[model samples]
Target: MATIAFASSSSGLLFNKSKETSPRNGASLFHYNGLKPVEAKQFEAKGFISTSVRCKTVKAAVSAPKRETDPKKRVVITGMGLVSVFGSDIDTFYDKLLDGVSGITPIDRFDASEYSVRFAGQIRDFSSTGYIDGKNDRRLDDCWRYCLVAGKRALDDASLTKPVLDTMDKTRVGVLVGSGMGGITAFSSGVEALVQKGYKKITPFFIPYSITNMGSALLAIDTGLMGPNYSISTACATANYCFFSAANHIRRGDADIMVAGGTEAAVTPTGVGGFIACRALSQRNTDPQKASRPWDKNRDGFVIGEGAGVLVMECLEHALKRGANIIAEYLGGAVTCDAHHMTDPRADGLGVSSCISKSLEDAGVSPEEVNYINAHATSTLAGDLAEVNAIKKVFKDTSEIKMNGTKSMTGHGLGAAGGLEAIATIKAINTGWLHPTLNQNDLEGDVTIDTVPNVKKRHQVNVAISNSFGFGGHNSVVVFAPYNL
Candidate 1:
């Protein structure tokens, strides 16, 4: 019988054929190459009295996995831009959320006194003076204006100037900004014009501005990016889907940088009436400020919000080569569909739970490692509880994890919700403070997890997940972590 000498090190296991054997303490010594002794009975049957082999010490060389000179290509966020009701600046948006300020107010764009739901998280004092020409701005929808501003602001935040962009390969950049209800205002107006006067009354810019892909198209044109450009309209999950798709684009080497996020300007009269007709909006007309109360016992429904959120995502190697500021690393993300209801969450929460589990797996993280969750709780009765139940299924003890609902402050941005909430999640990682889920005075009975209710909590977040579920049973989750480098 031949004996095989084995040794182990940080590199890997090494094996050699030798009559003399020497084994270090705690090292597995085997009689044959590529064979491991499984049980004590097997060892005794082989007449081996000791677990350690007796042989002369020999330095056996074996090939080991090569370490990467630069870390494997990863997608990192270099800049974040958002146009919330609070403001467009990222600091201002997070400051208001940390301060527990409610952006919800009575819809002043039009007379909403007759409507059951009279308020929303409406953007006020928004101006696209420098970003778009006055005539073009007037012709375009607010969704287009918001997308342009936010996308450009993100590029600015990333320190990407016209000269800098020109120096790089223009074909390696792309835009994926999306909107749930693109140009609702323009579409509504065009329909009204056709009904009231004639076909000639319809503006020529109507089709260009009303389509969902126009935001990304205009962004690409403005930036001279000839790479991949498109829009994903997955209801409230639009932003997360865009993020996931954009990350995959970078990973697959299709683009080195991607301007990805979501935009929405559905606060028109038609938009308000549409949500009201579906009864998906809160009817708490008396207290508009407290209308969005996620995880609260008296919650009614989500408050419609209008804005855009955009992020500059680049391959880590590309960002480092350009000396760009790395905000955070996009660990991973996943999307799934319930295939159950068009407007309601699945009663069993299988879709959401599966989506979350798959996202963690995609991020290469364990459930216990996740400490924070930017919940998709939209203040609705079924939606909030359904998400909670789904989370409970993923995590065993919820005490270690602190979750909050940003919708309490920004209302539901619909397609833009995921992008804004993802910014909040990354801000929490950078700031070590988790914002509160406001108006959570009375907690739901089944929800045992800490909602971080009504006040900011200081805690170090190592790993966080942002959840966004949309109408049509679309479920999306994105995991983010602080960049070590």
Candidate 2:
């Protein structure tokens, strides 16, 4: 008979010594001499029980979870590109965020004067000149157009243009850009044409360009990539879902590189009108910039925003083989659903807390390691505080963790929100700065954590989590950290 000894620590379970009794019939088949014994009296003094042979007391060693060390399985961010209200450049976008610049403005793309919510974070004068042909550009929906531009720019940033692209196996590359209200502009136009001029007036491109998956398909066509190409429409959580899936494709050896993230250009008449119909938008027309105030006591609702954000994700083995510049490491991620409500998160914050815990577990990290959080924080009365509560539930100490809401400045980019925030998270890790949650005049009492209100703070981030929860109760959390050899 053998007795295996185990010790329970605050960290986790710790294995101690195992002792075997005298063999029956005075015959011993095996002699195990590798284990070091601990004195039972010493262990008892330290509150550790000893069920096996003991000698001298020794402190139990505590171990932390190790991140994925295998190069072939590890995922890294190589490049980033975005079409934001601030601009199309990644640096310019992050700079605007860090400065607490508000991108929200009066919705002039269409006549939003009649709507209750008259303002939005709209992208004005956006041109995909170098990325798409003029002819195709004229017909493509803004959602698809933004996806193409962002995806191509990401590839270019990764140095995957012309000669470099030609030398590589295109089949090993993939596109996974997702959108929430996919091609709303195109769909609205098609409906208008059908009602005014009948079926004959409906353009043949209506179906092809209006679907959500078209963005990923179009990017693949333009880039000649033959790997896993698709779109996930999880509302605002679409981008993180795409990132998670794309990284898995690389980790599974289905692809070497993935152009992934989210694109959303839903700031059309219908898009605005729909949110207004649901009473989910801020009606602060007098001051558009101050409308999106996440964690503020006076926040009415989230201000609608639109844009596209893309990242070039590659396996570490493939990235190092090509000498790619690693921006940050995609440690891990997780997705969950509330299943309680359609447009609102659970009041108890169970789903979100569980999702965050799972994300940390998947990332092989601890709550103590996460110092920064890019919150969904869409400024709605329920959503903003619900997320904060959820965060507080997962992270016991709010003192070390600093969280900021990008939607406070950018006004909630819908499907593109997660992608945009992910870039912001990585930038914070890289530059040692965290953007401010703007318009945070009167902070909510429940928000015990530092929300980084109104100004950027210099923070050397160890690990960061970007959160995105969507209208359908979709919850997603992605973990990122600085790349280390």
**Which candidate has the top score in lDDT?**
2
If scored against the real structure, what TM-score would every candidate get? 0.85, 0.87
Q: Tens-digit lDDT track for model 2 on 1-485?
A: 01211111100001112322333555322222221221111101122222222111112224456678889999999999899999899889999999999999998888877787799999988989989999999999999988888889989998888689889898899999999989998898899999999999999988888899999999888878898988999988899999989988988999999999999988898998887654567778898899988888887777889899999999999999999999999999999987754553444567777888888888977776778899888876656666776777776656778899998888878899998999999999899989999998999987889899999988888889999887667889999999998
lDDT of each: 0.80, 0.80
lDDT of 1 at 208: 84
Which structure among the candidates has the greatest TM-score? 2
Candidate 1 per-residue C-alpha lDDT over 314-381 given as tens digits, one digit per residue, 9 for 90 to 100: 99899998899999998888999978545544445677778888887777666655779998888875
How displaced is residue 398 in candidate 1, in Å? Answer: 1.7
The residue pairs found clashing in candidate 2 are 38-55
